[model samples]
Target chain A: MAHLDVSNVTKRYGDTVAVNDVSFSAKPGRILGLLGPNGAGKTSTIRMITYIAVPDAGTVRYDGRTVGPWSQQRMGYLPEESGLYKRLRVKEQLVYLGTLKGLSEAKAAERADYWLDRFGATDWADLKTEELSKGMQQKVQFIATLLHDPSLLIFDEPFSGLDPINAELLRDIILELRREDRTILFASHRMEQVEQLCDDICLMANGEVVLDGALRDVKQRFGKNTLILEFDGPDTFIDELAGTGRVRVNTRSAHRAELTLADGADARSVLDLALDRTDELYRYERVEPPLNEIFVDTVGEAEARRMQHESVTGTA
Target chain B: MNMSLRKIWLIVRSEYWRRVRSKAFILATLLVPFGFVLVAAAPAALGYLAEQNSSKTVAVVDQTGGQLADSLAAVSDDQLTFRPVSHPTDSVRAAVRAGTYDGYLLLPDSLLTGKGHATYYGMQGGGLTDQIQIEGRVSEVVRQQRLRAANATKGVLSILQSDVSVQNRTIQEVGTGADHTFAYTAIGYVMAFVIYFAVFVYGQYVMQGVIEEKSSRVVEIIVSSVRPFELLMGKVLGIGAMGLTQMVVWAAVVMGVLAGAAPLLALFLDPASLGVPADASSTAVAEAAGLSIPPVPYALLGWFILFFVGGFLLYASLFAAVGSAVEQQQDAQNLLLPVMTPLILPILFLAFVLESPDATTSVVLSLVPFFSPILMMLRAAITSVPVWQMLTALGLLAITFVTMIGLAGRIYRVGILSYGKTPSLREIARWATYR
Candidate 1:
């Protein structure tokens, strides 16, 4: 059974559809990346998933059953904007929040100590939350969110406002939680982080999911079949490549000329022709498209197609 | 139900401990009693010290064979030291210039028998005792001269003798004024006043508690786990416990002060030193006058606790709810008037209710839960309270108390999470009825 599933979820903030017709499911032991830029309904979708805001149309289910009051006890949500009582001691606040999540007092205390220690906040445990740095406070909030060991975790911009060291630490902790078979959904605009961490991805824009699939498959579908070659060749070979139906030279470097392959073209033929011309070629490489290139190309092409359609109808 | 109990208990425990251990709670509990002591003790001490610091000396210049001089001495107590001078006003004026006496009284020729005579004095105002003593002496002298002149009415002096005393006894519906110790009423009033202040002062603390939580955005975190009802109740109970603790300490201090007052007052103003017996009377004139000290204190205090707790809870719950409804401390003032009106109305009614506890209008006001606490306490101190009436009022007050908690909780639940919108009455009413 899926660890978490949000199906046909629709939420409207009084005529503003915040999350429209959203649906997804996540299995245990895998990270599902909810990827969207700012104002792309990421937070709204996460909120609906956590039951902070109820869906107007559909259901969010955990382990094949619909999410209800009981599911709230089993889900951990870290909101986009997190806050804690500044005057409270770090340990006390964590323990209080842990207990609020239905942990027994002893259990809450034990978990608080363990998590605070893990986050390197043991010394700051005695200090007031406000006295700590923002990164430190974020650590405390993260601990509070996960102290009860919920099966499903939703984090909105979890790596925001962190030094590299702390960000790496959070990354490691998230991976560790994934290893423990916890289903995770994180929303971020950082494509590199999502590419590195997520097995499944959902991209949203304008309150609707634009593209979502297994991260590998989606990248393959949007992959640009282009080869970046560095060779001591001349501009006449670029003309020869362009003569072959769909191959075009995109740029000329000081040491090389790069060719972009269009439909029904093989990179090896272009490479062979380049080699035939210059056996003194210093480097030859075929680079699979990076996730950033794929994301920009996919979103850019979609926007261009939308604009073209709008212009023909004289609406753009 | 279990979850609700668990959540409420969690909230209560946190609130209870947080407030109980707070420095403000500790200070308020310890400081207010000494404050009451100062208010009760300062005046009497000042009065006694003023009396001790000044002694009046009146010089009598009796130009009529020393008759007026001897009469002046007869009326003089230790407070008024009288001296007889042999010379006329000129010699007395010279003595007055020397500061030997505060002033002097002169007896002119043919002073007795209501004849034309005038006595001149210098200082004006604030010499009532001095003036009265001098006048009494002249009257005595004149009476003797009249008795000597008219021997036909020897029995006429008996008819002229009159002494007035008014006896006060306290009584009530269930207990007589004499049976109830005035000390009990004092104790009750002192406690009742503490409750009154606690509700007003600490109830504001509860309000500020909600406002703080709301402004801090902590209420969102709190209400997500524990319902706002739990939070509100927790705050009210926690603050109420703190208040009760403070009141207990204040009560102890007040009791100690009141216990010490009698000995201290007796030491400063010994009855024997004044040469006046407090209970001495030649006749039972005070009894015949039918005046008595009413058992006003205890009854008023009893009513005070009832109305005070009931009214305090009613109003404080609303205060807490209102506090949650607004996000800023400045905005809290908008909702304060309704709560404040009830609190201040009792203060205005205090004199009228205490004066006429059994008056129909006063009784009606006392039956009102808002006014009953202060008014009933005042009435209890002054007159008898009907048992059935007191119970009925308390019952109605208790009902109001429960209803307020429920009503306030509704506003709290919605308002705790609401931000930037100052909810109108209609919205709050909707919230109240929503769940």
Candidate 2:
């Protein structure tokens, strides 16, 4: 296992900076969630760490040495795009990929069979990739990524095409790999899975890192600003809070509502108002915001800033 | 090899074996020679069958008062039997219409004048050999009759009949090797075409292989394991090896056919009786005579392969870069014309090389790196290229191959990741120089 260190990595394509002044590092045997919306430089940063693209102004080091072909054997990457050969058999393609990643032929074949069976795809081992469904191909590709037993694994959008069951299967395998002390990093836009699976989370927007730290610590920094209210009454009280400057109601129903406290809002005063209006108040509490809300708020603010900047500068 | 090189070799090995196992490869390799055999033997067999079934019965009219008609043999070799028939021209036409005769030869009695036309009517046309035989017989009889009537001296008449033969000898001027135009031209075409065809055939393979990686998006995954350049090289060299193996199989089959089918072919064509070209190289003619067989040009063949490999690598590298620059096969179709121009140019100039292998234009073209692979093969066969020229051409070609590989590697590195739209030539060139 190896720690992946990426510092001040910047990549520019023509006039657009795809990755700008981004930095992230991972200790060995930990799952790091790389999160971003579209074109938010998540892939760019991960690509640098994987050594697929050289950073323009910073270094990507594994175990304090710069990444190169030697580092490749210790790393596995599954890019978002589907890549299995259509004409190749699942077993043969897996073995070929394993051998490419530094396994011996026999060892590759052995691991390939093992992984195929583990993924519940042994029955399709001899069948061509095209004969299998997209979900099945995704399964075989997942096996390919893990076939060489690399020290560090990187999966980009691993659950995109997977059915719920296969997604759960992948989640279990990733957790299993972590238990076996394999360092893992996966990038995705889906916040829930990241919240469920990550130990360290790095959120990016507008080619820059927006929020990154231990998952709990990042949530702690948000400081329980979300208000959850449930009561047996009409939902007018939720609307009454919507126009109020103290909170923004994210969702509402007749008897339940979730809201985020605006800056300088007092939760006690809000609770007092809710008690004043509602007869049977079943619940009223402030909780730490979910990763999804944080992600949307962060990305939305960054996008707004970019739009403002583009209008001010007259540039795209 | 080192670890990375070994990985590249794995790429090469898989690419080769994959194609080697393909049904297209097997069918092409196994069926082409048999096709050639069928094509070569079909016409000869059909002609023989037609000949055995055809027997022309020609009537002879005694319009010459037995002057020309008496000279013609009644049953001329059983191929065309001439029977004397006392019938007028109108009656002979009637017989011809009734199909009483296959044809009739009307000999006009112009008192032995050579100006009178002797008309032979036939239901159908004959082969060249048959026509020539009939023309020869008539001409010989007429000549003998004229000679007798002229009362010419025997020596004068005999000398008039003899054909003057010319012998060709080459005094070495600027080169060595055989001056047999047909043989040298044949070798030049073979060499030029092998290099041209092999380069084209396998170069596209390299391109398609790259497109495969890119379109499937395996390139990013692969680059994670090996450099983009390694993948490209592995593919280029791998596909080149496939083509080389196919060509070698074809060459072996050709040699086998040449050796094993000669006796069977000899039954159809007799070199001595049919009169092989007098000016053909004595070595080839001797073999044609079933005399002392000449040695194969192992050195020339070595040069042929050396040039073929150099050309294939250079073109294959460029083609691979083009493959990466495009997102789909349709995008690549537009890009191939420019890449194929250099390959096609030498072939277009092949005639120039054949006509004067030592001409200054030919020499310069054969020395030019882009044209050298094909044109030099032509020059080597037709004339003894200076050792310096061959080495210089090969050196320039090797240097070109290396330079192109470096450029192509850069293009492949970045272009593999850039998808969706095809880049312009300028954009692709920028990619080559990017990092």
Candidate 3:
């Protein structure tokens, strides 16, 4: 059974439909990347799932039951923005959030200590949140999101404002939580991180889901009809592939080029064409498209269409 | 939709404990009333001390066979003393110049003939106590002399003397008032202002609490756990608890100061200065008249708490709503002004209400939801307020309190997550009714 099932949830603010007919479910112990643009209804959908908002015309269920204290207690949410009391001590803030999520004060404090130490933020435990640097406060907020030992965690752009070292630390911690079978759902614009960490993905554009499935399945759905050529000689052979009716040269440099084959075309033909002209062909290979490319490919056309509509309506 | 008891309790506990532990709450609660008392007592104490430091000796040249000089001596208290001098005004003036006498007075020959024949002179001026004493004693002496000459003093015992002391009875009240002007004014005004100040001052804490949560963006996480309505209720009730605690502390401190200091201060103040007679005849007359002390307006204090709490919650709800709607304290200030406008309007007509507490307009204003919390208690203090009026004001306040919380809850739920800038009045009104 799904740990969280948000079905046909719709929300509106004024005349703006923040989320329309949004439906998704996350299996237990699997990470689902909720992908979206800035105004793509990710936060609104997350809010509805957590019961911060009730759906205008849908239902949200957790563990086969409706969202309630039972679900809210087991769920953790780290909003993209900093959500902390500036004047409150880091340890106390963590403990307060923990207790609110249903831990006892003693348990919350104990977990806060362990997390603070794990994050190498023990020195900041006694300091006020405002006294800490932005990165340090982010780490503290991250710790608060974990202090209750929640079964499910929703992180909205959690890696934002994090330094590289801290981000690496967070990446490792997320992997560990995943190993421990915690259901994780994160929304972010960072495609590389999302592609690397997410087992499943749901991409949103303009308050509606455009693509969603298992990460591998979604990638497969887009198909990887492409080839990579690495050589020392001029890559002008890629220009010939561009001339061919069945292939298009995606890029060409001094020693390398990438080519995408049209439907009913073959990567072997593109690779053969590249090798025939190259005096020193180091390598020729076929490869799947990166998630970023797929994301841009799918979302780009949607964006272009939106622009066209906006132009026609003069609403831009 | 799920507002569990534990969640609300947790929110309330946090809000309450955070403020109650602050040093500002402690200092303001314990010291403000003492400061007010110091302001009220400083001048009277300075005058008493000034009189104590300067003792006056006035010499009188009695042209009426020393009768007026002896009369002045008979009435002199410790503040001023009189000495009969066998000399003219010039000699007395010379003594004043020598600093042996602080001042002098002369009694003319026609002093006993109902003509104003007594004149006072001093190097500095007439003393505070000396002038009244001398005039009183001289008039008594002249009247005594006239009665002796007319042989009309022997039959005075046969005259029937009666005194009527007006005992103020309230038509439908538990307490009575003695003619004590001090107690009436003290109780009424003190209760009125205390409630008025707490409703605004503590109400600010509620507003600031909302602004703090909103500005810091912490409310988003909070609302995710507890409903915003629950969060708002917890906050308002928490601040209300703190306000009540501060009020209790202040009341205790004020009551203690009044208890321990009143007797000590009474030593320095003159009963006669307060318009009550100090002599035995006046005492006998008062006893004969049976003048009762006014009932302490203290009983009406329970009513004061009722209005104060009702008024507090009402104003506090609005303040919290404004706090949530505004992104900054400066914006909250603009909103606070209009919210406080209704309170200011009544103060303009406060004098009339105080003068005639039972007046039609005063009674009507006292029942007006916003004004009643302050104005009603003030009016009730001066005169007996009808039970029905008190009930009506209390009833209106209760309804307004519920309505305000409902309205503020709507605004708070919708506005807590809003950011970037202050919402306009129309925007706030929309939030207040947002479903």
Give native contacts recovered, as a fraction, per prediction.
0.18, 0.62, 0.58
Q: Write the per-residue lDDT of candidate 2 for residues A111-227, one digit (tens) a residue.
A: 988888787778998998889988888888888888888888999889886789888888998999998888889887777778999999998887999999999999998889999
* Model 2 lDDT per residue over B212-242, tens place: 8788887788888888888888888889889
Candidate 2 to truth, TM = 0.81
Tell me how each candidate scores on DockQ against the true complex: 0.18, 0.51, 0.43
Q: What value does the interface RMSD of model 1 take?
A: 3.3
What lDDT does candidate 3 reach at residue A11? 89
Question: Least lDDT summed over 10 consecutive residues: which range in candidate 3 chain B?
Answer: B284-293
**Per-candidate TM-score against the hidden true structure:** 0.66, 0.81, 0.75
Question: Which runs in model 1 stand beyond 4 Å of their true positions?
Answer: A10-21, A35-57, A189-196, A203-210, A225-316, B46-200, B260-313, B335-411, B421-435
TM-score of 3: 0.75
Task: Give per-residue CA lDDT, model 3, range A1-316, as digits (tens).
Answer: 2488888888887778999998888877788999866678988898887788777788898888889767778888898785689878899888888878878899999999999989888998889888988888888888887888888889988887688898999989888888888888988767777889999999888899888999999878877766777887666667666666776655667887776677788767666776687788888776686665566567885664453354345331
lDDT-superior candidate, 2 or 3: 2
Poorest stretch of ten by lDDT in candidate 2 chain A: A307-316
TM-score of chain B in each prediction: 0.64, 0.75, 0.65
For B1-435, candidate 3 gives per-residue lDDT tens digits of 243777788888888887888888888877897886666556656767877876778888888777667766776767777888988788789989999888887778777666757788877766555566667666666766656656775566234123333333223344353444446766677777777778888888899999999888888888777788878888988999888888888777866765555555655654444444444233333222222223455568688878888888899888988888887778777777778997677677677887777778888888999999878888877777889989998999899889888888888888887776787888878765444
- Cα error, residue B365 of model 2, in Å, equals 3.0
- In candidate 2 chain B, what residue range of length 10 has the lowest lDDT sum? B286-295
TM-score of chain B of 1: 0.64
Residue-level lDDT of model 1, residues B342-423, one tens digit each, is 8788777766765566889988987887766666666665566788878877887888889889989877876775677787
Q: Quote the lDDT for B311 in model 2.
A: 93
DockQ of 1: 0.18
Error at B359, model 3, angstroms: 3.5
